[model samples]
Target: MSLTKDGPTPPPATARRGFLDVRDLVVHFFTDDGVVNAVDGLSFSVEPGRTLGIVGESGSGKSVTSLSIMGLNRGRGTKISGEIWLEGQELISASTEEIRALRGSKMAMIFQDPLSAMHPFFSIGAQISEAYRVHNDVSKKAARVRTIELLDRVGIPSPNTRVDDYPHQFSGGMRQRAMIAMALSCDPRLLIADEPTTALDVTVQAQILDLLRDLQKEFNSAIVLITHDLGVIAEATDEVLVMYAGRGVEYGPVKELFAAPEHPYTWGLLQSMTRLDRKDQDRLRPVLGSPPSLIHVPSGCPFHPRCPYDAQAAPASREIRPNLIETTPGHQVACHLEPAERQRIFREEVSPGL
Candidate 1:
């Protein structure tokens, strides 16, 4: 995906343009302590044919950013700025009515927890059909047909009988597949999945990820996947956005980022992934320290406090916040130190074997 301005409009038509284009998006919440910058100056684009992963730790603005795009954070004392274009329409300034119309039809979200997303009282069929009926002026029978099809499409077995089951009746993995079915009820152009496989076991997680990939190919919908798991990003996304302290510290192709991570934060993330060397296998080396509070972030680099490279014998790594500079053709990094210097420190002082 060549990200040239001339390639496509901010939000092209559903048939002609890209699925989503977000530019300089800012979401701030008013709290007693102060303003919390949940999403600060984030920019990215998602074409209909590909998936974009927003990976970071909790409070890294992954979920908040996706919510902002879906118009789900309105009227919650949240102030938003910047442009969010969906299928050529600007969602930022769109009326509540307009956004409501677009919610499950043109755009839909599959939340992390299926138990919470589904209504306890409503049967799976009822909830799924309701999603379709809310968007389209179809009869209940037609919506039921669509609902059953979606359930089957999402790999749910016995869709005919299971559709009548309640949320609690289904297992964890089944409930998640049901949620994906509901989100895809209207054949949405964009699917925003917020940690879709968070609480599931490893086997279930792999299944869900595979299901998502297959669905994307079938529906050709643009996906915005928000997750803390780098492995998920590696498997499912075409592009990766490494966010830190509400800002996009790095963004590029998934393979390139994983192969040669430019940002120190990204490097930290890669290093933290679990490694297997032999039959015994070793435990994962987790990233050190928690993220800073959004209310009172650090002055220079928000990640400077926890970054190991900062403590090394390098002056440029400690003093100033590095701008996200284009180090390579498509690789971008926000480090004051040169690429050669950072790579040297990362290979020598940080992860010598990597």
Candidate 2:
């Protein structure tokens, strides 16, 4: 990669893209043991007023991709490549100062844990106002007003009074709401929510999702929501990206993918989720085997070890890595199984249970 003091050299100009477009992104951690390929050649895009859900097991590179986009994957042992474009600008090639300027005002993140993310000493309002002041040329009083407005907008009850409460003072749901308020303090055009509903009760999760939808409608912002909940993906996202072992295995429109998923990995994920509609289901069908080690990922198809249909592809599945190919207009999957065989299995075996 070409580099100067500023940062990595920008790629040549390309055609106009979505509000946020990430292409062939790769993230690796040069640990003492070996290089951990946290993310490998993952690509996705989110347009204004739309949400993209990334679902996968732990250590599946979901969070790494988000951090890479936010420019938080910088350190001694970390390396990131590929393009992260917001609007017409390339981010991976941008300078530290440039990334810093865009972080809050142009793009912001609602982190998974609010308690650890927020300062214990500072009041909720103080933190939000401080973030607002950093980007906007406003007095403290004006910033405070904006904070309250954001808090109220995000459904924080009695925002004017509760704004003074510290992070610990708020419940888990409230803390998440506060985090959302803080993320939107600047009306950022792109929002990255890393497990925004994690740890909250079911009702609270639904409320948070609703709040996000409302906010998206109001601001027309592009959102990247990282979560393991397939239900959340079905309910909130326009598109779903199923990841495994640091790579995207299936990606497509949420409704169609969920209705008739193609990849065996995607089928396993769907089967694993608890279904309230299926009363006959005595137990959840968990995906067999464990995720592979990123440092020494399985050869060929990373998920072949656990894939029930691996025998169908046989030597190819074990010998060569499958490239992500478009099975339909906008849906893609990475697997060795023939499209006809995949559709047959899904139609005969998977759809009945689901």
Candidate 3:
């Protein structure tokens, strides 16, 4: 797919290199039960034209981290602290008005559900054009033209007439395409896609992923994809972040992390995937137990309770809460066990086939 030159001028060289940099991000919600730490000291960066996938099980703070970046947690008795830098500008310290200006213009998020993101009252074209008009000083006619162009660019057929139809008039895949068109209306510098293909069929999921890849290449936008699916991360991302119990336990290049995952939680995730691929008679290797409650997390390692290797037999693995150490170049893992021991477990216990 060819690049698009529809939006604002690109940032200068230095600024463009680090498009989105998040550091030590923490988000906590106050509830009657207790304070729930949704995101605890998470950090990552996405350079221009790169995709970073944040993967984990449900309630692992993936969505919370993305929403924190988008400043969507405001006014909810939620406490957030950390640095979210978009081209060196700090998003955490930015005021509501400032973040509002940046959203949908400099950075836009494609929600998991298109139905929730789109307004049922307005036509698809009107919604897409409105996104453009909100950021750019273009006339409605010009915005409408841009909207049609985006619709066609996103692989929607008969966009000229389809643009006039409301959200309910389109099929599930069409709605997702319309959502993508709206997200790209102002040609955002960073795109945060939170499970953008969740509700679609497998064929539609592939189409949406392809569309996102094509659009990212065309616009030169940094993308942060938040999803639980390893297949999606493996296929669509350059780097991966594995979150567990509100903290990042493993992070590195996709290839390195997949080949020799050091974290026990990551090993569990891989084993779970392997079990899914095995025959029905094969015993499924689930992660063992449920993730600990955020309100009252376990001591030492957050994943200790469910960790298969954190026991007497695996004495080395139960030592302490491991810091995220670099096991190899650009590959980091949080585990107490030695590299060789971890490798042995990952190869034999987790994935014997590999």
lDDT of 3 by residue, 1-354 (tens): 111111133223344325687766789999999999898777678887999999999999999999899998876779998668898798999999999999999999898889877999999999999999998999999999999999999989999999999999998999999999999999999999999988888799999999999999999999999988887888899999999978788988899889888888887787677434577677656788897899987776788777767773244444455556677777777777777888887778776643
RMSD of each: 3.7, 4.4, 6.2
Q: Which lDDT tens digits does candidate 1 get at residues 82-194?
A: 87889789899999999999999899999999998899999999999999899889999999999899999989898999999999999889999999999999899999999
Whose lDDT is greatest here? 2
Query: In angstroms, how far off is 54's CA in candidate 1?
Result: 0.7
Q: Where does model 1 exceed 4 Å of error?
A: 2-18, 278-283, 311-320, 347-354
Q: How close is candidate 3 to the true structure, as a TM-score?
A: 0.91
Off by over 4 Å in 2: 1-14
